[model samples]
Target: LVRTGFEHLYEVYEKIDPKGARLLEESEPYVLTYLDFPKEHAHWIRTNNLCERLNKEIKKRTRVVGVFPLKQAMLRLVGAVCINQNEEWFVATHFMDKRSLLFEELPQREACTQETIDHLLQVIDSDFKVCREVA
Candidate 1:
């Protein structure tokens, strides 16, 4: 049904405005990504409402704070907001029917290189030690 509607729109655009149709054709691959996901999940995947809402909330909170004393303080404030939002979502109405989710496992991430692992370990080890001598 969605694909049929998309095709009809393309046909109309091609007839009325060939340039507009060409632009749409260039974006066809990206626009059709929603169809690749489960129908139940398509609406959320196709929209930016969730991210826009979260960004608005963050901006409102930060506006009240004006300026943070440290980078860590800013991070803590945003992290707290995210935690609250996460808790709210658990109790809120379903975004999509829970039963419709496929619950498929995601592909495993690539392993970190030895150099990256060693650098991370160094940082972790340094964090446990004092930055300056006590005198």
Candidate 2:
């Protein structure tokens, strides 16, 4: 629904800003330039460009490496990359600002009791028409 890049900012700002053109011009410089996120919600942000670039880099590396010695080495390499990506994602301002809306301050609300799990399994089975969905 939303276009990527500064367009998303400009669109939202159009509706939110009271000053109209002047505010848009002044704010455009800030929004279009770099992400200026607050410290509190300084997590959860990403750009597809960065993801594509990283994937390209990983592919290039894979081509160079050719093969892994074992599955563990592959897992370790992928896990390290995931950690680095998570670090980067937390720092991006747009993501940090927006992502907080999607989550709660408290831990996830999960009912993990045996009865709850059984009920969950039954519901899932009924919905999907697949029994023994898990091993």
Clash count, predicted structure 1: 0
Record all residue pairs in model 2 with backbone atoms less than 3 Å apart, i.e. clashing: 45-95
lDDT for each residue of candidate 2 in 1-135, tens digit (9 for 90 to 100):
111323434444455454674566676665533333333433323335767867876676667667999999877777777677778777866554565456445343333566755565555445433432542
Among the numbered candidates, top TM-score falls to: 1
TM per prediction: 0.49, 0.33
lDDT of each: 0.70, 0.54
- Write one digit per residue (lDDT tens) for candidate 1, span 1-135: 444445656665576579998998788888887656565576777888887888888999999999899999999999998888878876778676676556584333356676776565555345434432332
Worst 10 residues of 2 by lDDT: 1-10
How does model 1 score by TM-score? 0.49
Q: How many residue pairs clash in each candidate?
A: 0, 1
Instruction: Output the worst ten-in-a-row residue range by lDDT, candidate 1.
Output: 126-135
RMSD of each: 23.6, 21.5
Top candidate on lDDT is: 1
Q: Evaluate candidate 1 by giving its C-alpha RMSD to the native, one decimal.
A: 23.6
Segments in model 1 whose C-alpha atoms lie over 4 Å from true places = 1-33, 103-135
